[model samples]
Target: MEVSYREEGVASAASSVAGRLVADGVPARLAGGDPTLWGEDAEAEAAVRLGWLTLPRSSRELLPALGELAARTRAAGLTNVVLAGMGGSSLAAEIICATGDVPLTVLDTTDPGQVRRALTDRLESTVVVVASKSGSTVETDCHLRIYQRLFADAGLDPAGRVVVVTDPGSPLEQLAADGGHELVLAPPDVGGRYSALSAFGLVPAALAGADVAGLLDEAAEVLPLLSLDTGNPGLDLGAALGGAALAGRDKLLLEDQLSPIFGLPDWIEQLVAESTGKQGRGILPVVGADPNRSGDELVVAIESDVGDVRVDGPLGAQFLVWEYATAVAGLLLEVDPFDQPQVAESKENTTALLALPDLPTGAPAFTDGPVEVYGAATAKDLPGLFAELLHAIPGDGYLAIMAYLDRLAAFDAPVPEGADFEQMTDAWMMADPLTLRTLLALRTDRPVTFGWGPRFLHSTGQYHKGGPQNGVFLQITGVVTEDVAVPGRPYSLGRLQLAQALGDLAALETRGRPAVRLHLTDRAAGVARLLAAAQEA
Candidate 1:
């Protein structure tokens, strides 16, 4: 199987990198194909073969470490497990513990409140596992510092309590040695995001009581199955998908349930988005719970468990099958199935924002005067209350009005230049709609900016802290029953706690900045009322 190199320069660079990897004893291979050849390429087939061959064969080597940690957790009686890291380093552990029925809490966000809540809300006997290949991820470091302070405040020993995972001679390993903490070294050459199947992800998965061994074995079996040929399911799928995407079909949809494959979609998103998104063309990868309905394009589902035969018969199968499908899709695109360009920028931006002392101010505030009231009460007479607020704030008072859910996407707009006011507003709008509306109401007639969402919030959350601040913040909170729970664990209240902490952090972000807190009993109804009031205002 072979892929043609398009731009000679790019091909040369790729070859140089591949050659270096080979010199370093890494099994490096180049898959190439012509961009104009549509679907005719051996690169896709090669990718499929390689992907299958690369799967881990066993998790037995990690079992001992996992057992030790689990025993420590049980012995120490820790109730919360904070896995600190970013990208693949953090995502794997988070997804496993968050999706599993574990008796511990997993905090994934970089928000101060998230760290605070993880430290303060749970029992003092919480255990922290800091995972990072480089050990210098700013967010992970910030979180480690926060945890250190909490440990100090609690008067607990840091050594033997916290675990640091990284390369053998990496700074993280050095820190762990100096701090007297347990150290788990990832393979030397393993990248941070790709280290999950290694000790990087194993420790947390085992601690969370997931079938880590099973997962690894499953992955190992998959490795040999992927080859750079149309006959290889993985490569074929990748090629077909990539071809479709290049052919102007920009949306790649993964059914629900398969969403928790953890970093899989993200991996694909980075691959497709970065590889194909250049030159004025890119696919918009979207993964979500398939509204249980389908139309137009083809649908394929893979099973999550092992020995699940992947039959392209029906539209949906299981998680493993879906992974195979992802591999195939990558082949079709003739691009490396891994790597993310914006990830480093994301970390850099977050670190820079954290280091900045002058947090943006002067944007609108939610309230002009002191707001002393705080309650978890649901609003009554929604329509009537909205009418009252509308009457209180008259004509053209609202520049933009969006529902709490809808406001999440408002920040998708590029930040304007020079106008600090617009930049801050965009940030606030993207952060929380409740905050944006309150600010708009307080400042009356300042062109409001915002968007709506369920997915938008996740996209813009990183930008809210990393980007320039330009707007007011109002965090909306409400109690909602658990609609879904990971099997076999304690009640899945972690999400609620996570949401509350996220909102709290957003509120605490600025001092003397306009912000409001509206606690509702019926979240859906409250959001409706908030939207109605915004429209009326």
Candidate 2:
């Protein structure tokens, strides 16, 4: 838990940004921007509302309250913990669970099979925690309704089993209060992405028996070290990277030495993309990617803790540091750090898609076996098709590989002999996608990024739909060979997976993104083909 702090490269790199913030009156003005310091203001109201500045102080309350709820779960003998939230709400806890001894299952995907699997297997012994800032996130709400019915069918009172984390006056709080579910109020000012240190993350961490107080202590150590005038580590970093982006080094390439904590990169992606990406200006986050080939990128190498993820050391400190850095980056870029104007476009489109009386048949404009193409039609022509897509990217453009598939850590099913590595590569590609991303970024002149389905929808989904139009989306979809059935539901998990995919596609196309849908029959082979095509291009 004692994470070593390497101040060598980071300190030098961050100096310029810190200097610029001072010159721009950024440090002094940030006080005006933060609601914690000056109440609500028109300029940075939304950004300031999210829990960045106040988290250290608020953690004192969150730790004890979350501990009490978690203790309740333990007293009730609830061993299985399932968290239902998307993007920022779930990412930090995902990392914590992965790094610590906590066994918290995150249900962030809309992949029906996974959802059914999570809810059906251990309903009697599980405690379902719904974390959402607005208390009205579409996925969280949809999931809560299903779980509510599942609990009802199991003859268990859903009220006693469910817990919620949201702002005081949000619908989520009302639901928890009215239904008798455990209600944990996140700081009213904190937004979704910035709520990691707030109840949104702590409740789950505490449920998993993580050291909530220790984490706050670690954060406390770093909080005072982040002031702009003092040239502290966090401020130095915030200015360095944020200033670089404003000067056209906009692709923030993140290389991960942080294993078992792969969540860090994704966490940073949401922080950077959602916060700084806006108004035709943004930092395109490249996570777990070592393009090893750099072009207009500011490479950030993260050397994570050598031991298990714990709050005793720099692990907890890192979050506060990055959060502060992101806010400062926003200040330097002259953009509101907290507001997400474009994130709503995709949500509205998804709602519209989900509401249609009859879903449209997703017939392809181009066909190739199980690999049907909506635009690029033939297998032999795929490499060129992809190359053309890559070629079309502007100097400032970026590439996003959006895959819809099961991202299991290990494949239990049998595979073709000598295909285990390839199959595993296929699976890991969906989860991390760093190897493939590095390959693509190296081959092209643009920054490359990747994420699993429904998962990224909650993270980079907003930037993809709302940020600069300078993005090319390569959406990968495949048929689920196996399916998990949701009892009493008309459709199986396989059907639901396709529904979410189609809905997202509709959302993307409606937004005018230059995107392509590649259909594959076999998940492994298809992903392999996509990789081959990207490299060939």
Candidate 3:
């Protein structure tokens, strides 16, 4: 049961890297040795090296793919872009779309209804980009099926309308070739989550109309700047943080506005968790824009101002810098900086859920009078529409509950349900416990609605961050007042700061989880500005 480096040669190499860091005044430590925990094997070491080495070359090559994607998207007369993938495959794209004012939708959820709705409703003619490193991920496969169904329904050629990005030899590559779909290849050496600079990120960036070439160029330029021996920021930062972790500090915190960068945090989590967690002891890496220290030891903040600014794009740069720094920091701690065990558990849970039978359906009838629409000018004077369905025949309760439960469950499951057929009334009631009173207030078949701000912020935000890592967050912010003038003194500034703090906390709470934000200026405007901004930069 002794915890020590299993391979003398690998240990020696790691020690060499640690020695270089120490010589340059950076702290460095080692992690491994537990017979029970899976330590670094030869493959892990090679993967780490390959991850680092491919950065420069991948950046150079990804530029052309991005340019071509942009050209193709424009040529197809498409305005909206939909990215379908899960885990590392989709996180980077989600991050980029969230940062800019790009009209893009990302389907990271495995929930069947959510995916079906995205494809049938919002993504009808939109160009769909499917990204997966292994090409065999269940969630990605499910999404591809939905796309195919939607394409068939619309009478469109699925192959011509779809694009696939993956490793050259992956099953997805073969599928793309067989289907005659446009294909983008990730470097053979690059892992999925780490392939942000590869085709995984570049295609999405192109769809968002971002300067993908600039992003890659910026990343490539930083490769030479990272050195294990020199006091290079990347190396030194990694060493200091990793060393601190080995010295009994387990938590790493990232602070930034664009939350999507937490995708990199997810990437870091896998890196640190799998690499260090091998031995009897390991560091717990948590990614958040707002650091909430419950009992965490090491707190490393990527100074928002420093590093390569031009290359990172608005939000992408911030994430790239943080991701690079995190890797370097792990090196300083002398831990193998890549590996993830929790992923297997996630997949296992998803598979189990997918095999379960669909829930029953039943909808309760609404009996209450008209709903009091607050902020509405007409109010009670408007048509007395039944806000709740209390008198109508109850819809299939089992199906509705099943659907609702499926949505909530997928927040925690790796493979989500494809369809939710539960009664809408019963499903709404089950989804939110607080909605009981609201449900009692409505009548007829009208949808039971919840207040946007106060209720969602107070009730859902808790589970969004504090609950199990399975919840998905959708933050809706409306600018109805047009920068409403606030009294200067203590209240205005205090409220603004508080609002920012809460937003930051929400962002942090859902870090590495499924989340999206819709910021709209006017409530009257039909279109709510929706983007997957949760993990942007």
Highest lDDT, which number?
Answer: 2
By how many angstroms RMSD does model 3 differ from the true structure? 17.4
- Scanning candidate 2 in windows of ten residues, the lowest lDDT window is 304-313
- Given candidate 2, what's the lDDT at residue 514? 75
Better of 1 and 3 by TM-score: 3
> For model 1, how big is the CA root-mean-square deviation?
14.8
Residue 339 of model 2 has an lDDT of: 78
Model 3, residue 223: what's the lDDT? 50
Which lDDT tens digits does candidate 3 get at residues 131-176?
8887876556656776776677778888777889888798999989
Model 1 weakest lDDT span, ten residues long: 307-316
Query: 1-537 in candidate 1: lDDT tens per residue?
Result: 112223333234334433333353222132221222223443343332332223264335667778887887768777466677655565555555544645444444433333444555664767788887767754466567667766776888877568888877777888898999888776654444344566766786677666677666655554444433323344434434544454433344433343344334444333333334322233444333232122212222333221102223111112233344443344344443333332344334333443444332222223212111132212233333333333333231212221223222234444656759867785544444445345334434322323222122232222233222333434444443433232232322323233433343443244232334444445444544455454544
Q: Over 4 Å off in model 3, which ranges?
A: 1-40, 43-49, 122-124, 258-281, 287-295, 304-335, 349-537
Task: Work out the TM-score per prediction.
Answer: 0.55, 0.85, 0.57
